[model samples]
Target: MTVSPATASAPLARTPLDRRVEPDLRVALCAAICVGLALLWWVRGGWIFPLDDAYITLHNARVLIEGHDPNYGVPALVGASSLIHLSLVTAFSLVLPGEAAAYLVAGIGPVLFLAGLLTLAQRLSLPWPEGIALALAGLASGTGQFLNGLETGLVMAAVTWTLVLALDRPSRLLALICGLLPFLRPELGLLSLILMTRQTWSRLAAGSDRAAALRAVAADAALALAAASPWLLWNLAATGALLPRTMAAKQAFFGHPPGSLPASVVYAAAMTAGGIGPAAAALLFLGRDGPGPALLWFVSLFILGFALTNREVLAHNGYRYTFALLPIALFAVMRLGAARGPSVLRLLILAQWAVALAVAVAAPTEIAAQQERVAQYRAVAHWAQANLPQARLLIHDAGVIATASDLPLTDLVGLKSPDSIADHRRWTAPSNGAERFRALDAIARRSGVTHAIILDDAPDHFWASLADDLRRGGWSLDPIETGSARGPYILYRLAPPTDPAAK
Candidate 1:
């Protein structure tokens, strides 16, 4: 057979897949680096419980495993932020002690997150060096939350893989992941919505058959609904609400401040810049034909959502809410660098690795700082547990101390109480602190609360007012001195009013 010139050149015209280099060795090397960093974090600070919020999940898990309502004594309230995460921790707690299971899950989370990033990079078919660098960058970006035991790492991994799969092609797995997202974190469902919308649009734009596109959309919807129905039904039955109480509480507490929208956008843009620097800008502006739209959509939606609802909360906790952007930014860099040349890719990879390495090295210090903040709370919890074992306590930071103390607690912030949320809504004005505290005091008295634990540096004005009210209103304000590194938490002993008519 005669070989034509066109046919010979066709091989060179083949897609990038034909030119793609094997990434297994690079994947292994990246995985090894990630594992080493994870191990360093584990050895240094992984075991220390840094966030009080984590204990709320742990406590709920225990309650569920023991066949009670997940909200401890609050039978009808759905307090946990992530039902799926709580269920997973609950399953682990069944085999191990609750605290141990919580720590173990948190400890293993970063390792899995790192592995997921490398897998994603390999899936994207970047050069091995770039893949390793991206994974390292992801590791560095998430170090704080990975050590703190929040669902941030798990959600980040899930979002990365789901986006990868959905962008590559729509499938039943994508649908299933979409369904499970809300259970992981309610806001994560937004990611699923974005992916689904993008996939549907892509299918239609590609001139695929209408019937096929319809079928794909239908399947995605059905599977997502199936995966999410149980949680949705449970929430409806338990809380008579579509979302958890925690969501409402957060929304109420951190509703968009007037004129802050522009500032919020600036803050989010700044965060994206800090995470990926000029590379992200280059990818967005220069690589418009690539993943720019998707990246831009994700980042913009995330920023707007938080800005309108809880940008301050996002700002707190080391910018964990924005952690998903790290992987997205890395993906953009990979695409941009590959289009540019190997030299550009190498430089980007090196820069990413340096950032990641610095974060990994500083993991211990971050953990220690977090530990110091919670030290006073831990001491107070221990003291309360030992001395006032039967006293029902009113607590502002309701997770760790309440869990550790094993006392009946009225959570003023409402993570574990439905009534507290209702009360907060009734007292939304800035001037209502005195009235709110008075109402809270009444509620506490009705609930038989004999003591209150208040943090000295609590930023909430209502909490500060409550403390002052207790001091002047006949409650004995005794500051318990702890040798803890963090100082000044008060343990107030509630005393009955001197006159019966005063009540």
Candidate 2:
């Protein structure tokens, strides 16, 4: 009934569990739930992920398993958003089939994610039930994102447990994990950067033993970087950039300043809902105690960065970027003792599971719809793979195509082709559709692109009125062959090689 501000490091000793419960028992519940959900998904979708991007990683894993060069046209076609996720799936594929390996790594993340909550509960000495509630509430806030094949469960597990470790005390282990953040997911690296920035500021402001504090900061920062050095060095060596081509691709295709009031509110509101507290709670608990200040710092700055960088302003991307703020909020409200784990938590937990269940029921159908489009494109892709073996296919999205056929691809959005980043920009430019199509058609012709396909149903922000654009641009469309996959796809023949040998 009372709100008390305390430091994030303060002990949550108000109500310890009266009965002892084995940690493994809590862990087993998490593992069981994860398996059950995966089974439900597999039964319906047959290993097709709700997100096509999952297949990108799956395809790359198979490439590694076969000992083929992972890179395609470019040496830096790292091909996955998470190097860590790709590496884990590749390792799992050594013993299991490629699809099953992807499935296993996928399941481990949520298991570790929920298990880490129990670990947090034990460290806080809270009752076991509260731990499960926090975990479920987490699922609710980002239910759809976790199953997205972005290695979300893993990213969350690392972030949540890292927060847990940071709360306990600083250690070499914590430094190692903090350094590994970017490999988990690039957005997560922001968490470490923000937390360290807070630590550096606090120490400097204290005005005592300044040299000692600076040395400590430098050493910890070095350790964190050292832990991440391999992935960092490899990216730099291969791509000549610190971040992957994905960043460049995103910047070109969907990057926009977060200037719109409505878009900003929707983005902030989603964070507020996920954190399960009013947005103002961030200001209240910040700098009061615990990781609350640092986490709030991370979320705010991340939102700022995203607003400046993204055109897709909704909270969850098909490639999920949100993580850990829920735990941070839960920790904040609980440590502050605000409303003492409100009764509303029960309703919220039920709602989250309901969403997860709903996703399980609906995701298969959604995947089927995507597959219909994938099949539409696949006809062109398969023919190129067999008939014109040396030619590369250019397409809008790269995930399913990467796995479905052996055809090499130049990603229209540039995930696999950094050189096309400008083309991606032109394709998604705010310009009229006909103008956009002419610009792209010219580029494709010059690049010797013939087997090019694009989705007619992409978001308007990406491109608009494609059928009109093609007609206006003096272009004719080739309909895909008859099948279940026949849909609104346009194949443009930009100078198909006449002689079979010319291709």
Top candidate, metric lDDT: 1
lDDT of each: 0.65, 0.60
Residue 102, model 1, lDDT: 74
Measured with C-alpha atoms, the lDDT of residue 299 in candidate 2 is 66
Query: Which lDDT tens digits does candidate 1 get at residues 1-503?
Result: 11112210011133454334334554565467557756755676545567778777876776676656422376433567777778778889889877667766665566666666666555545555566666767667677777576787777777767646744555788778888887787777777787767766776676658888787778778888998899898878877876676867755433444555788777766765664433455436324543357557766787777766655566556666666666666666666655565676678767766766776687778777667767767787888788877777887776777467667888766677667666656653233343455446555656667878876665655446667765554455555554445554667777756663352
In model 1, pairs of residues that clash are none
* Residue 151 C-alpha lDDT in model 1: 80
**Candidate 1: segments with Cα more than 4 A from true spot:** 1-23, 26-46, 69-72, 75-77, 205-208, 254-260, 271-292, 342-358, 372-376, 429-448, 458-466, 469-476, 481-488, 495-503
- Cα displacement (angstroms), candidate 1, residue 424, comes to 2.3
Deviation from native of the Cα of residue 498 in model 2, angstroms: 16
230-323: candidate 2 lDDT, tens digit per residue: 9888778767877666765666655454357567655654654543333224334544465666777776776666655663533434325545
